[model samples]
Target: MKPISFIWILSVWMSLDFIMHGASTDPFDFDQVIHFKIEIPDAGIEILRQSNFQRRWPDSSHRPKVKAEVRINDEPFKDVSVRLKGAAGSFRSIDSKPALTINLDSHIKDQQFEGYDKFYLNNSVQDRSYCNEIICRELFQRAGIPTPRATHATVELNGRDLGLYVMIEGFNKKWLKRHFDQIGGNLYDSGFLKDIHANLTVNVGKNPEDHSAKNNLIAAVYEKDLSKLLPGIMRHLDLDMFLTHVALDTLTWNWDGYAMKPNNYRLYHNLDTGKFQFIPHGMDQMFQNPQGSIYPRFRGVTVLSLMRLPAMQQQYFKRMLHLYGTVFKPKQLVNRVDQLAAVIEPELKKRSLREWDRNQRGIQRLKDSIGARGDFLGWELSAPERALKFPDAGFVSIRNWKTSRLRGDIQFRNANENNKQVLVIESGSGINIGRWYSQQLLTQGTYRFEARVRCENVVAAPNDLYGGVRVRASGSRINAVLTGTRNWTWVAADFLVSQPVEEVELSCEFRGMQGRTWFEEGSLRLVKLR
Candidate 1:
């Protein structure tokens, strides 16, 4: 063949290969900073201005979108859809640097910018270091949980530089395709603070029909019998993945996430596996409490239910231990934060020297917190497990309960009730979820928890599932509570321990809008069944 012909043929073959394989690289490249310039017309700017001043969050249906022209790394793209996006902490006015979501294919079908159909530019006001989201997501991904990738970006909107922002992969068909075998499944976004049972916004599939998957999972969670419940849950939910997700969330101290708070998550109905998997989101604030508990009081209904099963609890602990040893390496995480800061600091300096300095301090605090958290979790996980020792009567008078404050204003103290020193959990004129709880380890068996409880002016929150005053034991099936003014009453909850060695938390809880609850400390007893 002629040399010229051979050269032309080789060049054409290389071009085809580039077209086919180049898209495989991540658009949200962790090692690089993306440059984005968004141009919006005056009308679009006005819409943002109006929404910014609204007292309430704009309804999604009413949230107006405006046409925009975007340039990614000097490569221009036209006819994109742009809108302001944020929740409570991160939302900003148009005059300030606002978070934004852009859809490249909103107007022009099949159009994608840098292999991304949709993406988010977060202002990172809640995350001073601008690395929390990226780092947390990376940790989750390392633990085999499918999380959206994130990277740093310098964004300019309508000629106004927005400084440094965290660019994140949006949940959509493309993101699904990258993570799962089945991309056609429904992806449910836990909008704002909603959970699985709520009318979640479907991000990528038909909603009314897709809602059935979540319903099925909820149904499975309601099965009280352990034999039936475990199998039922496994049929509709990926328990293995869910356990790992929870472990990572807990170790990272993601108090605002789904497993802990029933918020900031995505539930995807994997068509291929026919099981739902939770995806973590809004993880900008992490390690805020480095010594936070590895086993927090779960608020998500599904997670709480599973936690009641002792066998499942063992699996969860195993998952946490494995992930901590393998994925939650403190030195490695700190190094990652330093590497990210190196890439981000220069760009941040170009934006504002003062902010850049502040970011350096924030990054140091984050690193310190990461190290502290790793030490705490390692110690907590490695400690020898303890089992409650029973006396000749086969009962133990539970004492030395610690206080746990869930939300709003709450107070716990010892007070004289009927000439006895009783533990009191009082709501300080607001909604509250406070508990005096003690954790005890037990072997597989049936047990009875008994307590004397009293309440005055107790008004339960309409949405509080546990309701008013109650005595609950984790790792068992016990749903009983009391409301309204009542004299000291004897209450008992029978629970069954189903593991060789399982730790269970017994709580004297007051969950209400307003109330003063008293528990006879001397009367609290745990009796092993004959």
Candidate 2:
């Protein structure tokens, strides 16, 4: 054979061999294999003031009904069972209730796809239908926490494989009536859940004119005017319940819980007494640790998003921290972590073995599609240390300001280079370095502002060492000047707003002087004065 022909034939043979036997490498597919569609219609439930109902007839009001259409892989399963549950099982069984099933084999064929056989189970055992959800709730309850009962269903498809679905009872009228009768009417409106215009048209609210008519029981309670009711309601709610869930949630960094909309959180209210309760619900454990920061699936937006709105941001952070502290007391938090570790250890062992077998089967089925173990499925346990700490408050940034040139050099700098960064107010002439001072704004009353200011040796003028932070509100500006100081010192001032101001600006203005200056650890707070 000619040399060229021999080489060509050899190359072809090598190509065939490589195609026949090559190392398979690919990433795991995290995409869902089965699709789920949930339909929650309006007009199925009604909410009322817990104090309106008469005593001794708590069960008189009718319970709200729910219906859902579930589809998997474009096929509908008829004869699938559905389950429901609530705070009380004695009045009525919320488990394994029967539901109507519709077969969708014809529908799939109509769509030009392979036909599939599906079954529906409406009446299902609460324990079986929502096994995982029940376990989570049970764990919280065992830890003396408050959580709604988990109701679930299991469906048999083709008499071979099984699928699961869970249904959680809403803290609607029925649940609230029972609890409210026991406790006197005391409730506060939940800021997180409020009434919407659309819910009103659906008759979700008891009264037509009440702005809070469609608000969930939790929100209603939160919005309640009586201050006395809050303490009792908060007392009844198992703080331990919240802590257990939060601890588990922190471990998983459940982002999904944060993503749920207003009505998702379960609430309780009594028509007779007008009392209220709120509880967290509906969680699917999925999280992503980005930049070593655990981002739960439910926390759709970043923490920075809240910081943009200064007033709301301050209130939100303060409220969140207070709640966290209330639920997880220092000693209690440590103990809860130990309990969680105990639970997770055993579960982890079982999961390791099961996951290994599943991975093998999945690899065989997909062939080269199984990627790195940590690539898409590994769970993160701890977040970076910095993420666990509190973030600083300051005028983060400003644009198109009157003193843009003088304030141009002002930038944020890290105090410790390893710790959090602080705003660096650079020294320049004829420019006022302004920061949109973000402290809690008073809706009604007087407030005092104070800060510690220091002058460095690099400052050019000693007599002209005149620079002060200004507090501006509604066309009124109060200036507190710092003078005759070559080192860090404290400066204070007071301001009165005849009317409410949504926000206030804090600025350091340098008049007719140029040199470097350092400002650090600035603070502004609001206090009510008689």
Q: Return the top candidate by TM-score.
A: 1
Tens digit of lDDT per residue, candidate 2, span 322-409? 4434432323433433343333334333436563344334323222111221222222211122111222542222222222234534
The alpha-carbon lDDT assigned to residue 479 of candidate 2 equals 59
Sliding window of 10 residues with minimal summed lDDT for model 1: 53-62
| Residue 451, model 2: Cα distance from true site in angstroms | 6.9
Backbone clash numbers for all candidates listed: 0, 57
Worst 10 residues of 2 by lDDT: 24-33
- Give candidate 2's error at residue 106 in angstroms: 24
TM-score of 1: 0.72
Q: TM-score of every model? A: 0.72, 0.34
Estimate the lDDT of model 2: 0.35
Colliding residue pairs in candidate 1: none
